[model samples]
Each structure stands twice: as structure tokens, then as C-alpha cells.
Target chain A: MRLEEKFKKLKQEKKKAFISYVPFGFPEINMTGDICLTLQEAGVDAIELGIPFSDPLADGPIIQKATNWALDKGANVDLFFEEFSKFNKKLKIPIVIMSYYNPILQFGLKNFFKQMKSLDISAIIIVDLPLEESQPYIKEARKWNIDNISFITPTTSRLRVKKIIKYARGFIYYVSVTGITGPRDLSYSQLSKHIKNIKQNTEVPICVGFGIHNSNQVYRINKFSDGVIVGSEIVRFIENNYCEKNFLNKLKTHTKNIISR
Target chain B: MKIPNDKGYYGEFGGKFIPETLSACLEELEIAYAKAKKNKNFVNDVNFYLKEYAGRPTLLYSAKNLSKVLGLNIYLKREDLLHTGAHKINNALGQVFLAKFMGKKRIIAETGAGQHGVAVATVSSLLGFKCDIYMGAEDVKRQSMNVFRMKILGANVIPVVTGAKTLKDACNEAFRDWVTNVRDSYYLLGSVVGPHPYPMMVRDFQAVIGKESRTQILKKEKKLPDYLVACVGGGSNAMGLFHFFFNDTRVKFIGVEAAGFGLNSLNSASLSIGKPGVFQGANSYILQDKYGQIKNAHSIAPGLDYPGVGPEHSFYKKIKRAQYVSVNDKQAVAGFNLLSKTEGIIPALESAHAIGYLKELAKKQKNSLVVVCLSGRGDKDLDIVRNYNGIKL
Candidate 1:
């Protein structure tokens, strides 16, 4: 199903969407599929798979370490697709790839999106691609029925937000802080006001991410946002517990604890 | 002569490909720069420093001995005589002036060769602003003298030990710092390679090089030089020397890149072998793998040991406005010794790359007037040169 359709279905069911992010080939090459399956079982609405690049400017220390580890283990775009094809066959929820733009450009934009269509990938989030430079890639991604997600930050101006939302698809990612993804305190009053301002401009569901760690934070964000994205916290958990025998159980428990709120 | 379009692109190169968190900061800087460009006081303040403090209209010397040897009338645009010993001071003072105008109290910069670091430190000290410089640990070791100079100038020098331990990592660390302190700090970007207004602003400040050269060459030789040559690290020096002459189709421009071992090796000559990719902020020719992983770049000159060039240089290369060539470490060292012995001047390893190309240019064109931008002095590179020659010190 399309990512937009899934959001609509969640709205009808009166449940807030819970999205989880993990770097592809992290911990090990073949473990990502099992981790996604565990996240799905724990009530994640969607999965955002990170395609590791050499320079991930948008990420903090945790995500940077994970990506470096993945790259060191010989993870490449071709290798990611080879493993993801098998994972997609058994997955029911939508999968979105979060990558820097250079990777997609180097992989050939047309070929990358064509393969995404064939693999049933639902959307993509290019962290560094601003609205001004996204026209050509957005045009190609639309041809494959793949949504090109747009990012809005706390520092974004209202007029600029309107321009961004005009081209936004899938959903809007509201970065809760003016810094890289890591644990931090949230200001709900300001966040709520910002979301309300954005809501007046677009009809798409807005999901807040960055600095979100626990169920309390997720519950707080869900009060104003349509969904919550948990990234560095989950990757931090995987980094700490990947060697444990009951890694899946720990991951499942962690996911359930966050989503149950 | 042609500027980037409204969206900050130079023919499919140069855009603000940064994160959304820094977008507003870039917009603020762009607006500030636009306002400053029109403000008479701001213009006067920048020019005052360039003349009285940094020493503008630096001499254009005729290298008679080297000219005779090369069989060409070679002139040196003496950027080395500028305060802080390089052309980096032009951009450093300009950005610091802008930062002060915007009421920013603290300033940050990233450096590869430490020349830019020292330049920024010098300005921040003179202006009484809090300054912090990020440099790779490897560079701190190689450029220990510059590190001391920066500290003595009252700037904090932070050694970055991440991601190949070079200029690339230093820039990444600086970006992280900027995002955290975006409210009170100004990122005094050293070269013409960052997002939006930086490439344009740096070029504007450094264009004094070409402006003076144009007038000086006319006064001395009664005509425009047949060729203009400078070394390309992030291409600031070359851009400074080439910006005014860009519209003069009769004057040829040449930018030399540092090929550590050779062009085929893991060299830093991005304009020669790299593919177009977005890095640090701008779209430029970057050395990266097929999977878009940035590659490690090697060069004997710390300043030119970067994996990417300025976006304007990439644009110039694409349009064939400028020709880029590379010289290996051996050739650069040879050029360094030859210039020191013949002209009684020691050139930086980075500038030596341009000098190394003169032999080839002299062979191709005889009796032509060639202007070479002596970008910096070699004092900072003395230890490296000494060590390479088996000197204990």
C-alpha cells in the first residue's frame, strides 16, 4: 500500500503512527531483516532504512558510528538491494530509505528509482536535499510512484515552509531541534505551536523526529504530531545489545515499551 | 564575470546542499552579506583594513633570473607579502567584519594547512572576538609551528581526529560546532567552497588580487599578461587571481593541483579525476568511490590535501574557461628549491605546484608575459621540507 494510504488507515483506526529507523547492514549484513521483522511485531507502522554514506552530515555520533560500522562491513547500494529484496518479499509494512543525495546521484537516479519501484519501496528521505535542489529527483521519483519526503526544521521560516510543503509527498518530517539527532529535552508548547502553524499550510500528516528517545517523549509528541519517528535511540540500543544472545527480545521489548504509549 | 544564479548554482554546480537546521543560518548570512555590500560604512571598513592593515596593492615583482631561465617574462603577484603570509587574510578579515556587523561575538573556522587558521586567528585577535579553530590532528603534527601561531594569537585550536584525520574531517567538526552554536557564533569559512554566500563572498573579497594585478600589469607591461597561473586547494587563490580576468578571453587561466604521488594515485587533484558530487555543502568535483563514499586524498602540501575543489572551479572546468593540471610531490619540491635558489624567494608547497607548471608553459609559449600568483610564503612548510631532505630539525 502507498505510504499515504497507510497514514489514512492509521487515522481511521485512531492510532498514532510509530516509525522506526535503523542503518542497513548495521550490527551485521543479514541482521537488518530480522530487526525490521521484530520492530513490525512490536507495532511499528513503518520502517526507515538508512543507506550509509561516507559523510553523513545530518547525523550525530550514534548514527555516525553505526553508518561507519556498516560501511566498514562492506555495505554498498548493490549489497543493500540484494539483501532488501529478500526482506521485502516477507514484509507487509512500508519501507523508506533515508540517504544522502550523493549516493542516489552516483547510483544513477533513474536506475535507483526504477529498482525501488520493483522492490516495493514506498518512499525516500534525502536529508541534505533542500526543496530548491530537489526538482529533478522529485520528478523522477514520482514516475515510479515513490514518495519523496520533505524535511522541515524548527528554524524554517513560515514562507519557506509553504514552498516546501507544496512539493512534499508521503509525509512531512518535522525535525524537533536545530541540531543533529540525539537525546534532548523537548518543549511541547513550542512544538505544538509550530505543528499547528504547519498544519494550517498542508494536509499531509506531520511526524516529529530528532532527540526523541522514550515512550514519554513519543506520547508527548503524538499529542500534537500525527506520528513520531525514533532513530538514534533504537540505533543506540542495537549498538549496545547486538552481541547479546537475546538481542531480538531486547529490541522487541524496547520497541513495545515505546509504542505502547 | 558570471555569478551564480538566484538559487546559488553555477551551471549545475554550487548549491546549498546542507541540512535544514543550517538553512536559516545561511539565509541570515546571505541577507547580512547583501546588506553589507550596500552599506557604505561596511565597504569602507573592509577597504580600510585591506589597505592600511593587510597591506593592499602588494608588489608585482619581475622575476628576471627565473624569467631568463624559463625564456618568458614572468611576473609574480606577491600575495605572500600580505599580512599573515597568504591570500586567506582577505576573506578572513571580510567575514570577521561581517560577523561583527551582525553582532556576533564568537567566531569559528576550519583549516587544512593552518595558513587559514593563522589568518583567522590574526583577525579575531585584532578585532577582539572570541575565536576557535578546528584542524585535523595529523595537520597539527605536520603544521606545529602554525598551531603555536594560532594559540599565541589568542585562538583555541581544537584537533579533530575523525575520518581520515585531514581537512575533510576538520570541516565536518566545524559544521557540527556551527549547528550547536548557530545563535551567537559566526562560521568564518576560509575558502570558496561552503554553502551559498560563502563562495560568492570570499571571491568578492579576494578579487582585490586580480583587480590590482590587472592595473599593475597594465602599468608595468603596457598590456594584459598572456597567462595567469595559481594553485588550487579550495581554489580561493586561483579565484582571486582569475575573477577579474574571467571576461578577458585573451588572457589564459591555469590552475595547478597537487598530485601527491601521481594523478593515478590517491591524489588530491579533484579537478583532474574526480566526479561531480555534493560535499561539505556545495556541488563540486569530489574524489569518491562508485558508491558515493568520499575517498582519502593525499598531497605533500597540507593546504591542497582536500578531496574536493571549489564549485566555481568545477563550473570553470566544465565550461572550459580554465585549464587544470597536476604536479606530483617530487616536482613540487623541485619547483620549491628552484624558485628559492633563482629568485631568492621560497614558495609554499601549494604555490610550488603552480610554479612546477611553468616549465611546461615556458616550453609551449616563448616571450609571453605570464603572471603567477605567489599565494603564500614557505615558512610554515620549512619543517616538512627539512624533514624530506633528511634534516634532523
Candidate 2:
């Protein structure tokens, strides 16, 4: 399904979206497919699969650790697509590839988007490709009928937010804090206001991420925004429990438990 | 009419390829800096600090002996004699003034060789602002003395033990810090790389080197030098000297990049062996494998150990305005020793790369008037040199 369709269905059901971001090839390169299949089974509305790069400046220690693990295991763009192709057909929910811009540029943007189209991937989030340099990405993504997600942070001014959402494609990634992705004490009162301010400008769904680590945060954040993205928390879960035999079942229960909240 | 138009693109190279969190901050910073540039008080304050606190108009001495020996008209732009013993202080003092003008009480910077770190720490101390420096953990070990000096200047030296464990990682850590604290702090970038405003802003700050050298050379030689040379890491010092001479069609610019072992080995010669790719928030020539994952850059000089060069340097290289050449570890060391003996001035390993390329330059261009930007002193690199040459004393 397209990302818009997923959000529309969730809106019709009066349900908030539960999004999970897992670094590709975390435990093992081949294990990415299983994780995606598991995430979809675990009641995730959408999955944000990370393309690990050498330098992830926007990430905290947790994601950085995962990036290192993935790269050490010889995970590259081609390997990610090749390995994930097995489960791409099995995935029912929309999947977005989260990558820094260089890999996509190096992989050739036209070819990358074509590969994504082939895999039925819904959207792409280039973390570093800001509004200023996004014209090429936007034009190419549009050609591929791919929704290129744009990011807005709490630090973004109201005017800039309006300007960014003007070009926002599928959904706007609302970084809940003024920092990189990590678990931190976030004031929902302030965040809710930020979300409300964004909602006033665009009717597009806003998914909040960064500094959200627990179900409690997912619950609270879901109250204000259309979706909640759990990254470091889920990555931490996988990092700690991937060795266990019943990890997938536990992940389903954990994800189900979080969603029901 | 100029490069890096309002949007900050040096041809197709530079843009604000940063995170959304830093968008407003950088935009505000760019606007604020623009206003500050026009405001006489701000400009005067920066000039005052540059002259009074940091030291400016550093002598441009003609290296008669070295010039005679090499059969080239060689002159040295003595930035090593600046207050912080490197051209870095010029930018540090200027940016801190801008930080102060913008009401930011805290300053953050990333450093590799510790020259920029020490310069920033010293300026931050003099200006009474809270300062934090992010340096690679490996750099902290290699440049322990400069780290100690930074601590003595009351700047918190934070060691980054991330990717490559060197300058590249330090840059990553610093960007992380800046993104995290974009609310109340200012990121005083030490080089002419990074997202939009930084490359242009740093170039403007360090343009003092180019300005002073150009003025001094005209007064002394009554004509422009045929060649302007400086070592390129993130390419600040080279840009510092090269920016002034950019339009001087007759003057050739040579930027020396560090080749760790050799051109074929693990090296920091991104301009030589790398492809155009985005790293550190700007699109530039970066050392990367076929997968586009940034390759680890190595050099005997920690400062030159970077995977990417500045976007402006990329633009210059593309336009054939400046010539970039690589000098290996042995060549740089030899250059360091030669300059020490011939000119009686010990040059920083980073600066020595320029000298290393001089012999190569002289062989091609005969009796050419050359101006080499002696970007820093060798005090910060004594240990590495002593260890390399097996000098126990």
C-alpha cells in the first residue's frame, strides 16, 4: 500500500500509526527480512528501515552502535536490497528506507528509486537532504512516484515549517526535540503545541520521533500527533534480545503491548 | 557577480545539506552574520580583536636562502607567528566576536591538530565565553600537549571515539553537539567546510590571511607572486591564502594534501584519489569506496587526516583555478626539517606539506615568485616528528 493509503486507513479507523525504525542488517544482514516480517506481524502501521552509513551524525549512541554493527557485517546498499527482497513481497505494511543522501547519490538516484519502486517501498527519508538541496531528490522521487519525506524539528520556526510542509510529500517527520535521535525527557505539553501548530498549516499526518524510547512515550506522543516513530528503543530491544530463540514472539508481544497502550 | 550566491553554492559543490534541526539556526546565523557584516560596530570589534588580541599583519618574509637553493623566488606568509601559533586564531577571534554579537554565551568547535582547538580555547578564554572542544580520541593522544593547553585555557576538551577515531569523527561529534545544543550555543567551525554559511563564513573570517599577504607582497615585491601554496586538510589555510588570489589569473595556486603512506596507500589525499560526494554537510571530493561509505583518511599529521576537502576547493579544482598535489609522510617530514634548517623556522607538519610540494613545484616552474602560507608553527607536532625521526633528546 502507498504511505498515503496507510495513513488514510488508520485515520478512518480512528487509530494512530505505530511506526518502528530498525537499522538494516542489525543482528545479521539476512536477518533484516525476518525483522521486517516480524514488525508487520507485530501490528506496526509502517516500518522505517535504516540504510547504515559510515557517518551517522544525526544519530545517538544506540543507532550509531547499530550502524557500526551493520557495516562491520558488510552491509551495503546492494546487499540491503538483495537481502530484503526476500521479505519485501511478504510485507503488507508500507516500508520506507531511511538513508543519508550520499548512498542514494552513489547508488544513482534514478536507479535507487527504480529499485524502491520494484520492491514496492512506499517512501524514502533522506535525513541530511534538507529543503535547500532537495530539488533533485524531489524531482526524481516524483518521477518514480515515490513519496520523499521531509523532516521538521522543534527548532524550526513557524514560517519555515509552513515553507517545508509546502513541499512535504507523504508525511513530515517531526523531530520531537532539538537534538539528535536519542532517549531524553521530552515535555509533551510543549510537543503537543508544536504538533498543533504544524497541524494548522498542513492536514498531512505528522509522525513524531527522536527522544521517544518507551511505550509510555509512544502513547503520550500518539495523543498529539498522527503517528509515533520508535527507533532507538526498538533498536535497543533488538540489540539486547536478538540472541534469544523466542525474540520474534517477544517482539510481537512487546509491539502489540505498546500499540494497545 | 560572486561565488557562493545567496544560497551558498560554489558552482555545484556547496549547499545546506544539514539536518532539519539546524536549518533555522543556520538560516538565522547566515542572516545575523550578514547584518553583522554591515554593522560597523561588529566589524570594528572583530578587527579590534584580530589586531589587538590575535595579532594581524604577520610578516611576509622572503626566504632568500631557501629561494636561492630551490632556484625559486620564495616568500613565507608567517601565520605561524600569530597569537595562537597558527592562522586558526584569525578565524577564532572573528567568529567568537560574531558569537558574542549574536548573544550566544557558549561556543563549540571541532579540532584535529589541536591548533584550531587551542586557538578557539584561547579566544574563548579571552572573550569570556563558555567553550567546549570536540577532538578525536586518537588526536587527543597524538596531540596531548595541545589538548593540555586547551584545558589550561579553561575550555572543556571532549574526546570523540567514533568512526575513524580522528578528525572525521571529531567533525561528526561536533555536528552532533551543535545539533543537540542549537538552542543556546554557537558552533564556531574551524575550517572552510561544513554546511552553507560555514564555508562562506569561515572563508570570510580567514580571508584576513589572504588580505594581509596580498597587501604585504604588493608592498614588498611590487607585484603579485606567480604561485600561492598552502596545505589543504579541510582547506581553510589554503583558502585563507587562495581566496584573495582567486581572480589573479597569473598567480597559480597549489594546495598540498597529505598522503599518509603514499598515493596508493591509506591516505588523506581526497582531492587526488577521491570522487565528488557529500560528507560533513557539504558536497565535496571525499575518499570513499565503491559503496560510498566514507573511507578512513590517514596522515602522519593528524590535522591533515580528513576524508574530505572544502567544497570551494572542489569548485576551484573543477575550474582549474587551483592545483592540488599530495605530499607523503616522509616528504612532509623532510620538508619540516629542511625549512627548520634553511629558514630557521620550524613549520607545522600541516604547513610543511606545502613546503614538501615546493621542490616538486620548482622543478617545473623556474625562477617563479612563490608565496607559501606558513599556516602554523611546529610546536604542536614536535612529539610526532621526534618519534618519526627517532630523536630521543
Candidate 3:
């Protein structure tokens, strides 16, 4: 199902959407499929599979280290598709591929989109691609019925928010902080004000990310926004427990703990 | 000669391709720069610093000895004589002036060869603003003298040890800092790379080199030089020298990129072999693998050890306005030695790439008037050169 349909279904069920992120080849290349399944079974509404790039300016040190390790483990665009294809058919939740534009451009946009479409990927969130430069990609992705997500930040002006939401699809990613993605304290009052302003402009579901670590943060964000995205915290957990005997169980436990709130 | 379009595109090569958090900051900078460009008082302040502090209108000298050897009337635009010993001061001074105008009390910058770092530090100290410079750990060791120069000038040099341990990694770190500190901090970018206003602004500040060279050459030779040449790292010096003569169809432009071992080997000559990709915010010619991961670039000159060129250079190359070529480490070393011995001048390894190209151009273009931008002095490179020659400096 398309992301919009899934959001509508979740709205009917009255369950807050829970999103989780993991680099495609993090911890180990072969473990990506298992990780995604664990996230799905742990009650994540969607999965954001990060395609590792050499320079990830939007990521924190933890994700940067994971990406570098993934790259060293021979992760590439093709490798991601190969691994993702393995379990995409069995996955129930929508999957969004988050990547920097360079890899997609290098992989050939048409081919990359075709591969994503074939694998039943729901959307793509290109971190570095702002609205002014996203027309071509958005137009192309639309042809494959793939949603091209747009990001709105705390620093984004109201006028820009209106302009961005006009082209926003799948969902709007609301960066909870004014910095690279990592855990930090969030002002619940300020966040509510920002999301309220954004909600006035569009009916699309708004997802809050960046600096969300524990269940309390997720619960607070879920109250103000339609969805909560947990990335670096999960990546950190995977990093800390990848070699442990009950790695999957621990990761699933942590994932369930955050969203269960 | 066409400037970037309204969206900051130079024929699809330049744009503000950063994340959402930086959008407002970049917009603020763009608005401030636009206002500053037109404000007479701001213009006067920058020009005053250019003349009195950073040594503007630097001399254009006839390299008599080198000219005799090359058989061409070779003239050097003496940016090497500018304060901070390179053309980087031109941009650094202008940006710091803008930062002060905007009420930013702290500045952050990224450096590869340390010239830009030193220049930024010099201006920050002079302007009494706190400064932090991110440099690759490898560059910190390779250009230790410059690292010391920056430290003495009152800038904190942060060594970045990630991803190839080079310029690209340093840039990544600086971007990380700017995104985190966007409210009160100014990112004083050093080259004609990065997002929109940066390529445009840095080119404008460094355009003084071309402006002075144009007038000086006209006064001295009674005509514009038949050719212009400069080294291209992120292409500040080349853009500084070439922007003025861009419309002069009679004047040929050449940019020399460092071919570390050779172009076939791991090298920094992005314009020659790299494919077009977005990196460090600009869509330019970048060395990347088929899967789009940036490749590690190598060069004896730390300043030239980058896998990408300025977006403007990519536009110029596409329009056939300039010719881009590569010179290996050996040729650059030879160029360094030749200039020191024949002219009593020690050109920086980055600048020597331009001089190295002149050897070939001189052979074919005898009797022609040619101007090369001697971008920097070689004092910081003395140790590297000495090490290359098996001598301790």
C-alpha cells in the first residue's frame, strides 16, 4: 500500500505511527533483513533504511561510524537493493530509503527508481535535497509511484514551510532540532508550536525526528505530531549489542520499549 | 560570463543542496551578502581592509628570468605577496567583514592545505572574533608549519581524523559544526565551492586579483595577455584570475590540477576524470566510485588534495571557455625548484602546478604574452619539499 493509505489506516486505528531507521549495512551487511523484520515485529509503522554515503553531514557521530563501517563492509547501492529485496516481499510496513543524492545520481536515477519500485519501496527521503533542487527527482519518482519526502526544520521559515509542504509527499519530516541528527533535549512547548504551525498549512502527517532517544521523548513527540522517528538511538543500540548473544531480542526489546509508550 | 541563475545554478552545477536546518541560515547569509554588496559603507570597509590590511592591488611583476627561460613574456600576478601569503586572504577578509556586519561573533572554517585556515585566523584575530578551523589530521601533519601559523594567529585548529583524513573530511566536520551553531556562528567558507552565494561571493572577493592584473597588464604590455593560467584546488586562484578575462575571447585560460602520482593513479585532478556529482553542497565534477562514494584524493600539495573542483569551473569547462590540465607531483616539484633557482622565488606546491604547465605552454606559445597567478609563497611547503629532496628543513 502507498504511504498515504497506510497513514489513513493508522488514523482509523488511532495508533501513533512509529518509524525506525537503520543504515542498510550497519553492524553487518547480512543482518539488515533480520533487523528490519525485528523492527516491524516490534510495532514500527515504517522503516527508513539509510543508504550509507561517505559524507553524511546530517548524521551524528554514531551513525557516521556505523555508515563508515558499513562502507568498509562493501555496502553500495546495488548491495542495498540485493539485501532489501530478500525480505521486502515479507515485510508488512512501508519502507522508505533514505540516502544522499550523489549515490542515486551515480546509480542512475531512472534505474534506481525502477529498482526501488520493483522492490516495493514506498518512498525516499534525500537528506541534502531541498525543494528548489528536488523538482527533477520528484517528477521522476512520481512516475514510479514512489513518494519523495520533504524535510522541515525548526529554523525553516513559515513561508518556506508552506512552499515545502506543497511538494511534500509520503510525509513531512520535521527535524526536532537545529542540528545534525542525534539525541538531545526537546522543548515540548516549542515543538508543539512548530507542529501546530506546520499542521495549519497541510493535512499530510508530520513526523518528528532528530534528538529522540527514549520512550518519554517519543511519547511527547507522538502527542504533538502524527509520527515519531527514532534513528541514532536504535543505531547506537545495534552498535552496542550487535555481537551479544541475544542481539535481535535486545534490539526488539529496545524498539518496543520506545514505541510502546 | 553569466552568473548563476536565481536558484544559484551555474548550468545545473551550483545550488543550495543542503539539509533543511541550514536553509534559513544560508538564506540569511544570502540576504546579508546581497545587502552588503550594495551598501557603500560596507564596500568601503572591505576595500579599506583589502588595501591597508590584506595588501590589495598586489604587484604584477614580469618574471624576467623565468620569461627568458620560457621564451614568452611571462608575468606573475603577485598574490603571493599579499598578507597571509595567498589569495585566500582576499575571500577571508571579505567574509569576516560580512560576518561582523551581520553581528556574528564567532566564525568557523575548513582548511585543507592550511593557507585558508591561516588567512581566516589572521582576519579573525584582527577583527577580534573567535575562530575555529577544521583541518584534516593528515593535513595537520603535512602542513604543520601552517597549522602553527594559524595557532599563532589565535585560531583553534581542530584536527579531523575521519574519512580519508583529508580536506573532504574536514569540510564534513565544518558543516556539522555550522549546522549545530547556525544561529550565532558564521561559516566563512574559503573557496569557490560549497553552496550558492559562496561560489559567487568568494569569486567576487578574489576578483581583485583579476581586476588588478587586467589593468597592470594593459598598462605594462599595452594589451591583455594572450593567456591566463592558475592552479585549481577548489579553484579560488583560478577563478580570481580568470573571471576578469572570461569575456576576452582572444585570451586563453588554462587551469592546472594536481595529478599526485599521475592522473591514472590516485590523484586530485577532478576536472580531468571525475564525474559530475553533488559534494560539499555543490554539484560539481567530483571523484567518486560507480556507486557514488567519494574517492580519496592524493597530492603532495595538501591544498590541492581534494576530489572536487569548484562548480564554476565545471560550467566553464562545459562552455569551452577554459582548458583544464593536470601536472604530476614530479612536475610540480620541478616547477618549484625551477622558480626558486631561476627567479629567487619559492612558489607553493599548489602554485607550482600552474608553473609546471607553463613549461609546456612556453614551448608552444613562444613570443606570446602570458600571465600566471603565483597564488602563494612556499615557506609553509619548505618542509615537504625538503623531505621530498631527502633534506631536513
Q: For residues A67-156, write the lDDT of model 2, one tens digit per residue.
A: 999999999999988988888878889999999988889999999999999999969999998888899888999999999998989888
List lDDT for all candidates, in order: 0.92, 0.91, 0.93
DockQ scores for all the models shown? 0.73, 0.88, 0.89
* Models sorted by DockQ, best on top: 3, 2, 1
Assess the local accuracy of residue B200 in candidate 3 as a C-alpha lDDT between 0 and 100: 93
Native contacts recovered, each model: 0.63, 0.87, 0.87
Which regions of candidate 3 are displaced past 4 Å?
none
Question: Backbone collision count in every prediction?
Answer: 0, 0, 0
The CA lDDT at B257 in model 3 is 95
Better of 1 and 3 by lDDT: 3
Query: Roughly what TM-score does model 2 have, to 2 decimal places?
Result: 0.98
Q: Clashing residue pairs in candidate 2, if any?
A: none
TM-score of chain B of 2: 0.99
Preferred candidate (TM-score higher): 1 or 2? 2
Candidate with the greatest DockQ versus the true structure? 3
- Indicate the DockQ of the complex predicted as candidate 2: 0.88
